[model samples]
Target: MAKLIMVVEDNDLNRKLFCDVLKAQGFEVKPIADGNEVLSAAREISPDLIIMDIQLPGISGVDLIEAAKKETSLKDIPVLAVTAFAAKGDEEKIREAGAAGYLSKPVSIIPFMNAVKELLPG
Candidate 1:
């Protein structure tokens, strides 16, 4: 079965780009445009991986990742943080929040896929 990936991105172009790329790679992609909708959508979908955007409409992706990590049902799911913040300390903070992998935007196709593959379960 194809792995299900949930992409939480507020930007229309980015969301479409992610979904298109994941789909082409044979993964099932669920694009969530609003941060507020992520948790409930994740619970319902039970996606294998989550591609989270750091700056979001409602809540920060770091906070969302931290929150998801606390939920028993969602804790095990791998989170791949995609952010525009490439500052020296930012990656560490995102990692501390519980992202299994991190990629900066605008992400290159190969590296993005590599990060996704590395985070997905076998």
Candidate 2:
């Protein structure tokens, strides 16, 4: 079966781009704009992987990752943090929050796909 991917991003354009790219790559994608609903949505979808944006309107992505890690059902799924903040220490911060990997925003399709592929089984 095709892997399911959950994209939690607030930006309309970025969300659309991410969904389009993942769909083109033949993965089932669920795109969500609200950070508040991340945990519930993830639980319901049981996604194979998650791509989360750090800066969000309600709960921050970092907090969501930390929460997901504590949930037994969701903890095992890999989460990739995608953020616009590419500052020196941001990667470390995201990792500390329980993200499996980090990707800077305005992400290139090649690297983005590579990151996703790394989390998914071949």
Top-TM-score structure, candidate number:
1
Residue 26 lDDT, candidate 2, scale 0-100: 93
Number of the top candidate by lDDT? 1
Candidate 1 lDDT, tens digit per residue, 82-121? 9997899999999999999999999999999999999999
Question: What lDDT score belongs to each candidate, Candidate 1 first?
Answer: 0.96, 0.93
Superposed Cα deviation of residue 66, candidate 1 (Å): 0.2
List the candidate 1 regions with Cα displacement exceeding 4 Å: none
- In candidate 2, the residue pairs with backbone N, CA or C atoms under 3 Å apart (3 or more residues apart, or in different chains) clash, namely none
How far in Å is the alpha carbon of 17 misplaced in model 1?
A: 0.5
TM-score of each: 0.98, 0.96
For model 2, what is the C-alpha lDDT against the true structure? 0.93
| Candidate 1 all-Cα RMSD | 0.6
* Model 2: per-residue Cα lDDT over 1-122, one tens digit each: 88999999999999999999999999999999999999999999999999999999968899999999999999998999999988999899899989998999789999999999998756
